[model samples]
Target: MYDSILVPTDGSEGAEAAARHGLNLATAFDSQIHFLSVVDERSYSSALADLDPTVGEQREGFEQQATEAVECLEEMVTEPPVTCQTAVKHGVPHEEIRSYAADHDIDLISMGTQGRTGLDRLLLGSVTERVVRTSDVPVLTTRHEPDRSRYDRILIPTDGSEAATAAIAHGVAIADRFDSTVHALSVVDVGGVVGAYDAGPGIPELIDSLEEECEQAVTVVEEECENRDIDIVTEVVQGPPYRAIQEYVDREGIDFVSMGTHGRTGLERYLIGSVTERTVRTSDVPVLTVR
Candidate 1:
């Protein structure tokens, strides 16, 4: 359903990987691709002394880097070419990204969870996390370069909340486009439930009730896939939701993951950090998060 896709880059290998995936989607949908690189003025302004002679030079260096980054991605677009555009802006990286998407009427934002200056750890790059948390549109993120032609299996994890259900249509749309099998998963947070209360006589019955809820949740997804006449598999598992999702991806060889930015317990402003944020931070495959 994407008509215009935006790929924000910092010229990192991670950003390049995301660009490749964004290009693949653009090619599939005959969509226009916009490559944007943002020079984070704060990075230099906060470090250098006020009115320092080097400050202007540092800003110019960053702007040049931004231009080069977009140009590098532009060069990658060829052979059955999709429409492409490029731009560089000076601002907070995440704010500039959101503004670009809004100003360009972007349909999808595909970006990397890590960048050249990213924290070398399991957490997502700060800018990417901010965009994912606050963006008003769907965001597709990845940490590794993916096989562009290999969206053969798509996973959709659900918790039956309105937020979780909101992701199902997007997941199904992508599967429909790729002719991929849909794996509908529901994770029961046994540990969270148990820890919230005493592990006493009522626990077994509570667990069974939770498992039934999980089954019903997956059933909803199953019905959606069936209505679309898409091949589908459904399952219910018990664990921390994000860990269960990662395990399922590894076990099933999932090619992509689609999830809601928030879940049943999500706060109004914060994402369900333990689940969606963790999955975005740690997923080996690309994740499309819908709010």
Candidate 2:
């Protein structure tokens, strides 16, 4: 469980949406929320050279905006007794975010992204992707768009693997908290085997056995969630893991994807390299990845 959450806000719509979810998480754990705004000092410094000698007003404007951003978030921290704290620092956004989280002993970081893709993302270099990749702690991220399902439906993507179960436990808690229904998904990497070759003798039995295996595997996961009284819905899909999860999220109108980090680098989680990394990088909705 998280003890304290750090959220970076640029006052953009994307960041505002993330703050909404961040509050829910902070409330869940009775955790304090740290809101930070980075001044993009590199850009500011470059602009400074071109500013008028009487640029004092411009500097004051920056201070005023930073204060407004912090106060706005403080007002929003109405639930979970979130002890809202804010700081404005001058630096690159991602570096400032990572460094602050490290120094403050932040339990989790929740931030927003535009969810850029392909060339756009390649060109701009996503801050969310970088932070998720480099940060020592877990990250839950959101985009600018608001999700309508919020408290009604939650999605948990599983693979019937031990790693996937990590999300199941957390997902049940999430569903219970919102009094919402839980939909459990296990995406098998069956595409390769299915599309690879021609049928052989007893292929029918093999196919039947495979289907049964999928059912039994997913059933155990669903039953565990049922114990928590979270109305359970289950699905078995075939494709690449990340693609299947993303497609299921889109098709089922999922509000959130709670997952786990299977492999941790070491005690400090100083390094993490897994498929979850790839999924978080591509997911469009908010993701809660627990280790």
Best by lDDT: 1
lDDT, candidate 2, at 165:
65
Q: Candidates' lDDT values, in order?
A: 0.84, 0.68
Poorly placed runs, candidate 2 (over 4 Å): 44-67, 115-125, 145-150, 161-163, 193-217, 240-243, 261-284
Which lDDT tens digits does candidate 1 get at residues 1-291?
A: 889999998888889999999988898788999999887766677456357879777677777888888999999998565989999887778898999999999989999998874321111288898998889888999999986666999999988877778889988988988899999998878887778778899888877887887888889989999999999999988887778898999999999998888777621111265579899988999999988
Runs with alpha carbons beyond 4 Å of true place in candidate 1: 46-53, 118-124, 266-271
Candidate 1 lDDT: 0.84
Candidate 2 structure, TM-score to reference: 0.71
Which window of 10 residues has the lowest lDDT sum in candidate 1? 265-274
- Residue 232, model 1: lDDT of 95
Model 2, 1-291: lDDT tens digits are: 677899887666666677888888777678889988766554434466366644545555555665566677768887556788898876676898899999999988887766223321210227776787677777787764455425567787664555456667777776887787788776545543455546566555554555565576568768987787768888876556567777888888777887766632222111134557766666777887765
Q: Output the number of the TM-score-best candidate.
A: 1
CA-only RMSD, every prediction: 3.4, 6.3
For candidate 2, give the lDDT.
0.68
